[model samples]
Target: MAPRRLDLARFAGPTAEFARYLRTETVGGFVLLAATAAALLWANSPWHGAYEAVRDLRVGPHALHLDLTLAQWATDGLLAVFFFVVGLELKRELVIGELSRPRQALLPVAAALGGMIVPAGVALLVGRGAPGMEQAWAIPVATDIAFALGVLALAGTALPTTARVFLLGLAVVDDLGAILLIAVVFSTGIALLALGAVVVLAGLYWMLQRRRVTSPWLYVPIALATWVAMHEAGVHATIAGVLLGLLTRVRADPGESEAPAVRLEHRLQPWSAGLCVPLFALFAAGVPVNGEALRAVVTEPLGQAVAAGLILGKVVGIFGAVLLVVWLTPASRPRGLSWPDVLAVAMLGGVGFTVSLLMAELSLDGADVLTAKAAVLLASAVAALLAAALLVLRSRSHRRAGSRHTDG
Candidate 1:
């Protein structure tokens, strides 16, 4: 009898833990969204130059341009820390989070893949062989996990817990695809010496892991060195965080216990949720648009293509692909979410603020940068608004139906 009871309790564990995690994510989501909006207004107001000046001023050692503009440091530097958190999340998920079980993993993984492939295909078509247009290919592929999850959180008791979990899992996989896209597509020039140094550092990091050096301080210096080396190696420096994080040994086996990795993730969750992400949003989210910028968004090929890819491509590609998968594979639908709920969540997937902004900065140069940024702002804003509206509507309907059932 004791053994049977233990089995039942073990079955109940994930459901309860996930419920608590969903609540935490929902609250954190609200705070992140508010901070991001405040930053946008501050960056664009009459004090815009102050925003630009603060971000652009350099502050490192005399010999090192180590002091990048506030924006560059946020996007290229601090955001690497964000990616480190991402690496942790990815590792955790693969080992135990949604991906731990094949049945649970299929829907989100398939949905994420469809989300990525369709957007790239659409962007490439829109680019239409123009000069520099090819660089825009990866822009549509990112799903801003924070903003997407946050918007769902604010939908106010309408989104079911099941839908929320599915969205979070889907976003993680989508982000993984975006990371791969960056490492493979955006990197054009490679410095062999810098790459070699990065490899050597990675080896050292692995050795440290083997020796069980789990202290955060020991890894900090190594992380910074890896970032510098990767920056010099002509790969985006942020990839350093991803690689380093991949090497970090989690103390606990999530599969067996809430391992060391899970513990670290929980500890860092608030910092990432509160500070790193919000600050990064403030520095990276601003797109100061003028009359000229409006004209460019409408006229520039790259800007126009990006806007279409994100706004149109994301909604159609993600929802449509999920539907096709459901039809083709009877086994593929996500549990705990109805088709209507899934479609509503698909609209939410359209909120591509963080990753879209990062891609705009990296993919365009010269005068095009301004235009691309404007496009990203416009596209993301529209997507978020539309997605939120649909989700609110769906929730109302779901609530009414539940009430009717209760009354019956």
Candidate 2:
């Protein structure tokens, strides 16, 4: 038989729509930044007691151990919605986007691995011999795509489209790594019976999609059941969102205008961006800043490690990985992207805002937790400012080069 042809047209519509979705998310990033600022201001203001009261207030069914504080619900529940969107995007990428081709996918995958490893290694080295500091190593291993993209958007239209694509791909892979870390590293007890139930529910969910069941009434309950089971199984409940999203059907039926996965992602994107993520930021980003906490963050090893890992480790890891890959396989670097472009993108990768905060909450508690959060906030801000400046300079250089070419 002759070589089989790949159906490239099958992915065109979804890919175009996904690009549009990313543009919308840039706007959401602004909203997210505002929410984070509000939380920080509220947490440190005179009304700090009220903010604490709201965050700690619990309302859920007691028998199910669901009566958690508002902050817990934000992380464990609302963040699941955000992860569901992430899952949908990841599934799309794996099936038809850039990741569909192994050659196209290699750069981002390798860079993400490097980005995560170097940061965690730096955190470990900095936190060496400090009690309870080792647990904070994962804090800087994530990249907040929203905030990074937002910074890019603010840099005007001079930035290369290739750069945006590269950053998006890298961040998605980084998220996959962080999710695995959350599942394996943070989970304490293994509740086998409940885990089995979760597996069963997951199977049922797969069956529902296979049958082309479009009713949310039927699927919602199963999704919720899976989430509850995962929580009870001592696994992170957000994994349920990711699993369900990945298992959803991505290809449309012959007569349909869109795939089920596309429809769900489009419908849920607003909720996830507008409410879920911002609300999580509101609760999670409210680290109280005071003289004592500020002093501790500057003096404490954990804080120093987390900050350094995010601000410096990301640059070294991502940029170094790109350089190594390009040097070993010269064909790996995409045309029109130079080393400076990679360096700027790598700098932006340090903005580990949202998921970094979540990991801090999961890994540390008490003064350490507060200190880690403060460090994350400061480090993320520094990274954003530095990335913004680098990106602006890069954009101006690109514009001037283009103008010179046109004049010639």
lDDT of 1 at 67: 62
Per-candidate TM equals 0.86, 0.93
Top lDDT model: 2
lDDT of 1: 0.73
List per-prediction Cα lDDT, in the order shown: 0.73, 0.85
> Candidate 2 residues 354-400, lDDT tens each?
89999999998887888999999999999999998988898898999
Can you write out model 1's per-residue Cα lDDT over 145-256, one digit (the tens) per residue?
Answer: 7667767767736667878777767887887887887787777689898899999999998898777676878777888889989887878888887787677665553465
Show pairs that collide, candidate 1.
55-70, 251-260, 252-259, 252-260
lDDT of 2 at 19: 39
Q: Candidate 1 — number of clashing residue pairs?
A: 4
Clashes of 2: 0
